[model samples]
Target: MQQRDSIVETRSFDHVPESERHGTVRTQVQFWFMVNATLITLFTGAVGPAMGLGLSWTLLAVVLGSVFGTLFQAFHGAQGPHMGLPQMIQSRVQFGSRGAVLPLAAATIVQFGFAIFFIQTASSSLAAITVDQIGLYDVLIGAVAVVLAIVGYNLLLRVEKFASYITLANLVLVTLAAVVVLPIGTMINNSAFEPVAFLAQFGAAATYQIAIAPIVSDYTRYLPSRTKGRAVSAAVFGGTLVSALWLESLGAALAIAMPDSDVITAIHDMGDSFGYGIGSVTMAVAVVACLITCSLSFYSGSVSFLSALEAFRTMKSTGKVRSVTIAIGGVIVIAGTLLLPADFLGAFTAFLSILGYFLIPWTAVNLTDYYIVRRGRYSITDILKPDGGIYGRWGVPGMISYALGFIAMVPFFSTAIYAGPVATALGGADIAFAVGLGISSCTYLLLTRRRDFSGEFDAVRAAPLNTLGEPQRSASASTDSMEGNIPV
Candidate 1:
């Protein structure tokens, strides 16, 4: 790990030494809280009301979905301290050093998509607050986020910890003001329940929470290895659940209050209802929160991109490499935001659904391999090998399970572009994510059952200590010792 006061983080894909481990579970809570409490989540919450679900049903769906999705997401956080590597880098264990590229590519796209959406939403809110120079706002916000990402992990945590307090206070005020100013009782009375609408709302909320799975561990990987798994999981679950439910429920209320207006404009109007200048302040705070999220996506996306590249060639985790990747990602985000369409909400809904679809199977396979099959014991030296050492170039069980899980979801998928037959018969309630999770988990377990892991366990035991106190062996030597030693 880099020095505590270093402005730019030096380590990228390398393992963090025990001596450098820092941070508490409390910081984890604040970081996740700040990340989820943003305009994007508010937009996600608005989906329920837009789908014609009553506020009551929207709230119920949000609660249930948040709980279910966060359960998977929070568990990923526990993997960070144990693996001491970037989330996707650790996936090399399940998917092989090379085969991990499949999930890495998906994770990279998801992060980029999130960065684009966050920047677009923040720019729109800024435009709503002042002049309509959305193009300029896009560049300005993207530049700030890129710089913050370049500054890297420690600084990002500091910024989020500070922003968490401000966002929390502002969100509470906005939620309270909406209840007093909006005709909530009238909106609830006017709307009626539809099963399809309720399920769609539930899916939206669930995916919104699950979207963080790929990057959740990136933030926690620097913590001490002895950190309690349950403590980390609980903190993450609590932080994400509370913030998401609050902003999303507020979004549902705002959508109910003004069905035709965009969420940002509706929030502005609601803030103005409280007072004259409060709307501008509220919008400004929202922009700050969104910027933090953009930085997070850029940072994690750059790390994932590097992990993917390592599958093909040797890559260094230097500051220069990190800066270049982030710069490239920022340019893409800026260009994408400039071309954003007018139907932002509709586009956002579809994006969330698709993002969740690709990610569900990957998360399912990863979590099962970690907690069930390998039981959190991994050989870091083998994971770093170009040929994948004991694990090999492609993880047959993981790859096949991922493909099978995705295939199983095809008939149940319900997206804007295509609705599967099962989905159509069930009134268009998309439960494809759940189906993928179950299929992937079960498939990976069943396939690995007959394989012998005793040799792999011995390799893990013989591996050098993951601390600065020990001198690590060359990659060649490590690979030579493990070659032909473990059975497939």
Candidate 2:
């Protein structure tokens, strides 16, 4: 047994010289939990409501989105921890350092938008819960942003622990509600439980899946390489399958009881009546759980965008500067969410669609470069230095494949006009994301055959090798043993 370190440590991969330091198993598990929490929260607020209104097809649309979206995310996300770098750094192997910027920038902006969406959600909830005290909500959001910024990436682990407790408690309450309701004859015959057309069900499921695709990696990146496949399975199933079931069942039951109110209101109504003493508590728990989940969305968005900005070469160095950037970015996202009408959901979906468009091509390139082109092996050293790096300045094959993937999805997604018939047919604006993921994955694999971009492939490369200077071995490549300083 390669005795796993009890403490986190950065170690050089002997076989892959250019790879980034890898994450530990515990970090990976926490990451997976956070991913599940984030998805559950997002769906509860956005997609869950849609399903309540739309029913079967709405459920189906969200599910379909999961099928396609997860395929791309699992493949790409599984590649990250194995490589020990953000998706953008991994792209340099194929896109060339400069070429990688296009997709990185796109993903960053989209992620930032999501962060904004979360701030908007939490702030609105605070505002509503407090009777429209605008400044209070804004301050609350600002506080969260500042705290997250201060805590940095370590927050991913800490937040998950807090969220897990709330989620577990809520789960128990929901289960109890389910057990209690199942025996009631009235619950079975509720109007909200009425069956819907098959097509509509499919449409709803598709939309929900697309909406959550961009953030899949935010959680997946921390997964341990050894457990990557299983973690992906758990994340996709737990997040999409379990979440859909919870929301759908709740929606149906609530619909039957209220007959006309929204699902959240219905849930609240149940607390007033038969929920015994747990109704108010359940509602409160659910609201707080959703808020925590949204806060994570904003945090992950900040990380992704900050990573993108750092790629700019012109941005100031130091994680602190990046933290400040993330804080500012979070505020901007809130502003965008607020400036738009209360129908921010539609705009949010559109923004996500654009992100999906880019993520598809990017994921395709990532997976292809990792699995097929390199045959699941790469030098850690080549990644750091631009000139001597095996990836070279720009990989024409990767650039071509990425371009081809992007172009193919555009017409189907109708991204050129920011409107697609698929959205209309799908009954929500999430289909474009799925289409982009599928097209890009297949196209990239087809375009790039098993060809090596560079010859020398060693492990544990240094940073800023291109325009910066001669490649100095990163801390990982030092002769000193990496005992407890590995990055997650």
Candidate 3:
């Protein structure tokens, strides 16, 4: 096990490296619990109600979307131990090594957006706690998260373990406070189903969960190689879902109970519901929760950026590469934050809808390729190699499916920037996310001809290499079971 003070993390790329894979499965659950049980999530959860779903339907959308989205995210996280690669890089088996860059770039953009989104969330939540110091709060939270990411992964795991407990308790207190003062009977009487609004919020809620797919493995990669895929999946699913449902449902409740105000304002009012000191404490805790989520945002943004470029492929997890990645990503996020509009609720919900448009197809294809087709086996060497290496630099099949999926769902996508005719016709409901997932998954399955079950789980190697990264004497029983013959 590497010690807590490993500075080599500065030069590392995405993966935790074989020598540093010392974390326990328990840490995986804790990391996610901390990641999901935070204010960004609370802000996101509240978006459905803010979208005009009222309370009842908003709550339903939160449950449906949270469950649906976390399935992909948790399953993706499972691949970390098996593949020893970050989530986006694992797509190389299907998209080919160089072609994989397309998705990597998409994932990076999502991460960058999320980093900014949550900072906005934090600053606003902080503004309620402090006296209109959102700018200072934003910079303060970003700097701390950047430093933590630069410190690297092991220390993060430790901090997250502790944060899980603190975050959960803080949220529970907020929930209780809100519930005690809320007029549930009146809010329930005011509730009624809005299909268009329900689906719109559903997509946003699910988008929040699925967006984590690109980064979940960044934390999961430290587990032992033989970790059970089912266990990893369940752990991630349980942790993410529990918190997502709770905070999001709470957000929905706040949206209805305090319709005139946004999440930040609602939260601030909740503090005011209690005495001033208690209110101040609750709001301050929310700021801390935002800070925790930002740490995750910064760390994963760095990992996604490094994973996109081939130059950082061989670097250690704690080396100069990682430090530089964090520093650069932080600067970009800070600059973007200053430049982008600070309409927290407006910007936050809008980004999620746009996010779903991208995530649905990518998550569909990646999950389909991994679990349904390949059954999770992948050749680490082939993934690292460049052009014509089994999965080559540019595989057209996966690329085509991804494009068609995007085109297929464009009609149902609804965003402030662009709304599809279908979305507009359906009273602004956004069903494009589901359409893309179904279309892409089925399309990829047909294109691959059920290759997942055909023993071609990952890229085929012309010559087998032993686990030691050296030439092997012969094929293993398991290797022989794999389909596809390569001439050596």
Candidate 4:
């Protein structure tokens, strides 16, 4: 074994001890984490509100956003399996140790923000249900959500496969219920909900998808590199595309019937349209499915925030933070839920619109660093340093590129102020994400022309260890006689 000292400047990726790196995370444990974290069922519940808003627009958003988001995030996911590092550490190349704080903070906030959105909507909906059963217990629902967050990611990972399988079944049942509620001809031109009219729905859908993009790697990292692309495609299709369609269509049909009802009631009405037995089961499945999503969202978001907090120089100047951050985030989410209304679209869309602004730039920067400049290879050592690292501490080129993209995007996104209609006409944050990505990619290419071609791709592109978590001694970094093979 190589007796290498830990780099004082390098941020620790995960707490996985050196000994454990060759162990646990390699097998089924991590695979399930990816699958469950991508919870398609919970995504369905979220689309419910959009259904009432406009189904056609919702579906269009999923199709466009999922395709684009999946393609970009897949590049980031490529790093996890290839480099065996967390997203924040991977980001250090682009953001610098100090500058990394911005993306980290943005990711953390969006994660926790959405966690709050999902948990609140689910809890509030559950409260409405449980109140009739146990007599006015909304607080009870919120309390249960917090407890779920405390249980953390590992437990959730174990339950996710089971939850997702059941949730898929529930989706089939609900789709049938929607058909049952409104026979094909019984409903007015269902196409009316399509994007032909309401552009806001497209913007809303794009924003929502952007909000969820960061967590793609949290799940995909577990996948073996050979199938990483497949996993990415599957997650995009199943979680975003299919799930969004379910929510939008179901919500729309319910609205057409009741006009004034919320998503929960529409679902309830769907169940009622069937017999009492089917209704009871659908309601039960919906609640459980929503809880599964909220729990995962809260856990992922908490981890992101903790990673960001750790990046702060004043905090630890490393990419790690205290466990308490999770608890605090959960509490805040719970509080937000209580404060916000139960309508999923109101809170989720508003949050996503804000998230899309920064998230687009983050994605652009990472893609530029990984694909354009580094060409899918980076020095582990360079990324560990706080300053004057190989990639250069606080990469100004990357940061400036992101800033420029953000500047261009803001006028379109912040239309409520001066350029309201102009911003709206500019096509919301989704366009911002794309345009920023293009600009950042072009900037990185133009700036790093000579430096981009030096590394040996073969040595760097070693298959990502299914088990490794800690920064092991890479072949280049090792002094041991048996340098090539990592200790089993």
Q: Highest lDDT: give the candidate number.
A: 1
Candidate 4, residue 188: lDDT:
43
RMSD of each: 4.4, 7.4, 4.0, 6.8
134-232: candidate 2 lDDT, tens digit per residue:
555655665565555445445545666676667666656765675565344554333352132333344334444444444554444444444445455
Better of 2 and 4 by TM-score: 4
- Per-residue lDDT of candidate 4, residues 260-372 (tens digit): 66656657666767765555566666556556666656556665665554444434423123235555766676666566654554546555556657778777777666655
Listed per model in order, the count of residue pairs whose N, CA or C atoms clash below 3 Å is 0, 41, 16, 4
List ranges where model 4 is wrong by over 4 Å.
Answer: 1-62, 132-152, 186-200, 223-240, 255-258, 277-280, 313-322, 339-352, 386-388, 414-419, 426-430, 450-488
**Alpha-carbon lDDT, every model:** 0.83, 0.50, 0.70, 0.52
lDDT for each residue of candidate 1 in 1-488, tens digit (9 for 90 to 100): 46767778877777777777899999999999987988878877877677778888888888998899899999998877767788888878888889899788888888978888888889888887789998999999999999999999998999999999998888778877787889888876765788887887788788778888999889998888778878888889999999999888888998988888877788888889987566788889989999999999999999999988987888767888999999999998899888877576466657656766887999999999888887775777777777787778899899999999999999988878678999999778888888999999999999999889877766675667421112453434444353432211
Q: Per-residue lDDT of 1-488 in model 3, one digit per residue for the tens?
A: 34446654542333344565677777777778777766556666665566566777777788888898888888887777766666777777777767777777777777767778777777776776558877777788888878877776777777788877877777777767777878766776777767777877787778778878878877787777667777888889988888888877777777777778776677667757854455566667666666767767777767666666763344444456667777888888877777777665465657655754666677788888776666555556666664525667776778778878989998887777788999899877667878888888888888988344323332232234312222333333355544322110
Question: Candidate order by lDDT, highest to lowest?
Answer: 1, 3, 4, 2
Q: What is the descending TM-score order?
A: 1, 3, 4, 2
Q: Could you tell which candidate, 3 or 4, scores higher by TM-score? A: 3
* Model 4 residue pairs with clashes: 26-466, 56-193, 56-194, 415-420
TM-score of each: 0.93, 0.71, 0.89, 0.74
